[model samples]
Target: MRLFEPNTAALQALKGSNINITLDIRNQDLADLAASQDAVNSWFNTNVEPYLNDINFNFIAVGNEVIPGSLGGYVLPVMNYLQKILDDKNLHGIKVTTVLPGNALQSSYPPSSGAFTSEASSVMSGILSFLSAKGSPLMINVYPYFAYASDPKDVRLDYAQFTAKGAVVRDGSLSYYNLFDAMVDAFFAAMEKAGRGDVGVVVSESGWPSDGNGNFTTPKLAGTYNRNFVKHITSKVGTPKKPGAYIEGYIFAMFNENQKPSGVEQHWGLFYPNKQPVYPVF
Candidate 1:
């Protein structure tokens, strides 16, 4: 679950539940936090320290898709401070990383020409260095829906939905049958080019919207995508680049959030706010 603050009762309920939690530091003042050790300490002390033993905290996401621009400069510093804090507190099991958007790359076609955008190169280098030092996986948000939406005429629905009848993309000897694997493999190739091939990858967010402006944004498709994704990850059939490697992932959201912006932003949820399933998942 995406955690912004410490909720005592909620955290208590998670104790012994066998559920892994990924805490997201959802604050806009990331630069200030990185500059101030006391702020970092206070934030962690109140939000994470008290619940460390109660919740199965697995990863501490420094930020979500806040890089490759003005705010990007603070990412590595913030992650470094957070990692240092965790190390000092003996929280070795919990990793520190940031969630990157697929657009962070300059190019991703063919999954072989993957590379970070020029604007993001310096920041990405630092982030990769920190992740490598900490032995943490690079968390990225991938959405095949956006890709298909951008070029529907060229992008087949079956391929995007992971039910491709034949290979839709061929990169050298590697043939890609679906967009999900292709997108992930693209990121893997980018990491390899960045000289961080040993670093692992994690899909921090991925899910299709049940309702949106697009024709494909239907409840049935959303359920199908999520269910297939669950099976894909659990089966240990990793992306072609890292075959058989396990890649951890999380569904985009659990409930439809009304606070989100209109259109597709508010629809990527498995359940309605009233606790009703939009469509059967799992």
Candidate 2:
């Protein structure tokens, strides 16, 4: 499934693809919307209801990586209001959730030691409760690239790219061969510790940048990472921690967004602006 922040042109472009979409609600004051039923209704009517039939909407992400802070406090309330609107409108197929950054967790090393930060604990609890009640998956954006970029001296490039070269991270008896798997398992561990192990996880965003400051952020490596990722998820092998569990994921972007910040931000695209493939993704 592909994810897109709601926009008229993009939605129009996807009219008949029948591809599942995770629509994002961005740039709006979620707190204000949560407090007012009229605002939520109007926003939905303008942004979603009109395209309900033409678009294959599966999830509504309230905000991307906005939690663990003051803005994060609005997540649960906004999700509740949005979910109620969906239920009232009989939109049962579309689940409401928010995307969280990998940094939301205070610690993720060793995978098993995963836990949300103290600042995020209370808010995450409420978010988890809402997700559990609504049967929505907990969305998280995991980027092994950032981890490697932060510590190139210690972090193995091969491990971050899924080519571990026989290297394994021993977290207890479990051995993690790749950073992606370890990162995902860490989130699972955190969720379990948070008392909501049953709630499913969706990798809302994961990808490598083709061009950036780091040496590893090259077109070839990006292609390799994405291609391997597609294979990994499609094989249904799951991660070591959540064996046999189906974890739905979406690649970071469809095109290189030039307006984004200078470094890696503009380079996480699978395609160029002219619609040519960056690499053979399939």
- Model 2 global lDDT (CA atoms, 0 to 1): 0.85
Residue 185 alpha-carbon offset, candidate 1, angstroms:
1.0
Clashing residue pairs, candidate 2? Answer: none
**Candidate 2 residue spans exceeding 4 A from truth:** 1-4, 165-167, 258-261
What number of clashing residue pairs does each candidate have, in the order they appear? 0, 0
lDDT of 1 at 260: 46
Can you write out model 1's per-residue Cα lDDT over 1-282, one digit (the tens) per residue? 755445677778888787888888775868788787787888888888887777789888887787776788887877878888888888899999888899899999989989999887888888998889889999999899888888899998888888888988999989999999999988888989999988898899999988765577888889888998888889998877789987998898888876643654648888888989989987
TM-score between model 1 and native: 0.94
Report the CA-based lDDT of candidate 1 relative to the real structure: 0.85
